[model samples]
Target: MISQAAYGAEPNKDRRIPVTVLTGFLGAGKTTLLNAVLSETSSGKIAVIVNEFGEAGLDHDLIESVEDEIILMQSGCLCCSIRGDLAGTIADLIERRDDGFLRFERIIIETTGLADPAPILQTLLIDPELARTTRMDGLVTVVDAANGSKTLDAQFEAVSQVAMADLILLSKTDLISAKVTDALSMRLNGLNPTARIERPVAGQFDPKQLWGLSGLRKGVRQEDAIAWTTSAPEPKIDPLANLSGLSKPKPVSFAPTPHDTRISSASIVLDTPIKDSAFDYWLDTLIALKGPDILRVKGIVFLEGIDVPFVFHGVQHIFDPPVPLKNWIGDDRRSRIVVIARDLTRPELQRSLDMLRAHQPKTGTKEEVLLGHD
Candidate 1:
């Protein structure tokens, strides 16, 4: 049987419409990112789906179609969904486009502040009906730089949203110190090593960086995949060096502690290549025991016999098949895996991993590798 995802495809152009799910906590600058994309002149014919028109209200020249929910803007973009469930709404939009009523090159679904992105992602990835017509481009999560740390600690939804994103936009950086921003960036990176964190100055960013990120497409470059799986940069200390204890009467810092943590990240870089079966077994055992606690797992693995490195992605218990790259990108060929979880300390997770034959031979059975807030 022909797969539904391959049926009635458009000619010349790729038939699958790329959809970006935009999510963030309340006042995390999601609306700001949306406005930036909408206002940018170089953007394509993008279709936007928001939960409330009032929340995303912006002044743009209107085209002919101005329904209660769906409004076509003069910038070759369409705004949709006054209020409804996401799955049904997206299906309706696809139907309209198929029927020649709507035209757009891509789609962006701006989710509510309190939304858990996993379900939205599940629909995009596995829903056969929608999967046929549309492909999930990537998730762009907006994070408030000034208040992000506290928000992540308090709200599980915010953590999950950040954990699952393909790209994270750090907004309102100007409102906070570079040290604070650096600290927040490190925390986010620990939570999700697979995502690229970008700072948007005054809600302005290049639209091209936000879209075309679905790893399944033919147009998806190997460079993008490598970039996604690469480790995050360490936070700089020099930015915070000016705050002296004697001069400033000692500054108070809420910087992360070794185990004060409910949610934390662990990234392991293996000096030697791992056997495929051994690596698989390690992951299976880890997830089976703590699937509910594990929020996200992503990495580039270098297998013993394989010439190419494969990228692995997992959300809770569900794991996507590893994607093999055409060639290694740079000089660094070591295998790196990052895990973000709740109530699991980096040391405990590392101990479990140290037991794996991939890194074993047991040098005291302790977790030597640490990631996030290092």
Candidate 2:
């Protein structure tokens, strides 16, 4: 645990404060980073939020021997599946500040390895409500220099984790030889050229390095973070199942022995444009049917004659209104859909869409058959 005497960053007089993000693959030494920051910073009075133990338990584990250390974190506040919704947790810190619980200069959040950095950043960047109160300093990634190479090669989450860092710490390099360390450093640089790399001796150096966050940031976009090597459900599920999975044994929407769910995701590319009204009707029916199960969806659509691709992001039932993009990221102009959730069958979702789309009426194209208009 970094002591209060070690911290130096004072709260901003007007409105700016640094909030450091401590992220890395599990057991990569994020706790070590927190310990370093807490123990060495010249700043006085700092607050830390972590995921491992009750927030302060992580603090205590970091510097367990320090007798004067006063650490505090409630268990209820620290949930297991907490990824990036720390915006709510951080908001609580402001309340505590008003009540005088602690006069910390900076805020630190460490996430579990299974988490995605994009959503966390989105909670910071996209949430205009939270942005008003907090400003992002930078992302600090603690890398396991010893076994990082294998993790990167094997895990999609690891690649995403490394891709989103602004400052990277390569810990435990001394345990390995110089040659292996140099190779890993090069690989890290290739993944994120912008991040400054520091090989710390167990985070036992000057705390000034992690202090300033002006240099740590990236273009606010998920294009760099989006990755999918994993496969979704089989290609047998119906398109209408996009709304509701085939749960009923009696066959409500074509039950095929229960492999997929009611709310499924499928990618579609049209040679021609879809009528705006028709698209709305389809979306409406889908949501009405099974919006509850639609976990996350990302797609780039080439709408009829619209030159630019339409980018869409949706979480569960909530969706960001579609945004027009200047162009697609790759050669395949066809739409790409990444659906993440349980009980979803991709094949049924696609077929239902195909049939419904074929049934569109020709009065400037609207849903009369599906909506029972004519």
Candidate 3:
């Protein structure tokens, strides 16, 4: 039977959509990389799907679809077997164009920073469902100049991020110490002898640095994601496969739940509610300091002052203000946030959350605070 993902007919029979997979550490600037592409190229229409690391969809909010068909996949890492499920999303994007919902020809799937390019690339070579129509154009991996060492030392995904990259973009080079940048370059060379490395602040280098990477080598040598290691976990780091890796182990994922922890990305709901001031501070600080380290951030918070819940979404350094939601989506009024970052630890994230909650008021309930009667 013809698959629904096949869109009832071949999108371009005898031709395929060249798909570029972008991977980097959680906030290494992949989204900015995509937006930059919009300005530099006039390729056959371009469609982008931004996969965030949260359960609730948020990546879509930040995407400025040049056309509605320019879609975003605010779901989990597209490197897993589950990424195969996104065949439907691909189908939808194509159908929309076929129906004139959009006007683009090429497609880009930008994975969360924490993603391993292995599984994602494998899907292109292996998934029978998607392989027929989509051609793997290349893999682009973004690395942060400031903390690339720590990420490479502590996270396995970091090494895989470099190894699988056809184009290695070293972002935020101006922020790191010169010595650190040199060390990072050496390490990158040690890990992946391949890949063309491009620096972020090299006086507006050609954005074309991200182009022309063919998927895995013709043979099966590229399929062994495990052999590509010796960089992550830095011996003690033990980065998980690209399929599902986490920096810390506070939460465990079960396959049966709707939580869908099968991928490297996951979401957490705070038991303690966050104050508006607190959440705002979190946004400002996270974006200011670690923004480049983050791939995407989206959440519905019960702000301390607003009567309605505030919705916020950000992709790396760029952020959009919060929009008010009609009412709490569900009665479990606790604050919920979905973070898709590469190599970020649970302890560190909780610390970030705790830091955001440090000085919040405990005098009244959320309703009392919102009414201005508190």
Q: 1-374, model 3: which lDDT tens digit per residue?
A: 11112122222232556778878886677656665565444343466666643421333444443223233322211111123356777766666667964556566777766665555555554555466667666677888878776776667777667754656778897785444565566556434443456666644766555544542112212212112211222111223422355544222221221111111222444545555555666667766766655644555555444444444445455443233444233454555555444344444555665564465445422211100000
Q: What are the TM-scores, per candidate, against the unseen true structure?
A: 0.77, 0.49, 0.47
- In Å, residue 159's CA in model 1 sits off its true spot by 3.0
lDDT of 1 by residue, 193-304 (tens): 6677888787447888897654534334666665655555544333343465234322335655333356667766675667666787788788888988787777767776
lDDT of 2 at 154: 59
Candidate 2 residue-pair clash tally: 27
Residue pairs in candidate 1 whose N, alpha carbon or C atoms collide under 3 angstroms: none
Best by TM-score: 1
Sorted on TM-score, best first, the list reads 1, 2, 3
Q: Report lDDT (Cα) of residue 299, candidate 3.
A: 51
Best by lDDT: 1
Of the pair 1 and 3, which is ahead by TM-score? 1
Estimate the Cα RMSD of every predicted model relative to the unseen true structure: 5.6, 16.7, 20.0
Model 3, position 118: C-alpha lDDT score: 52
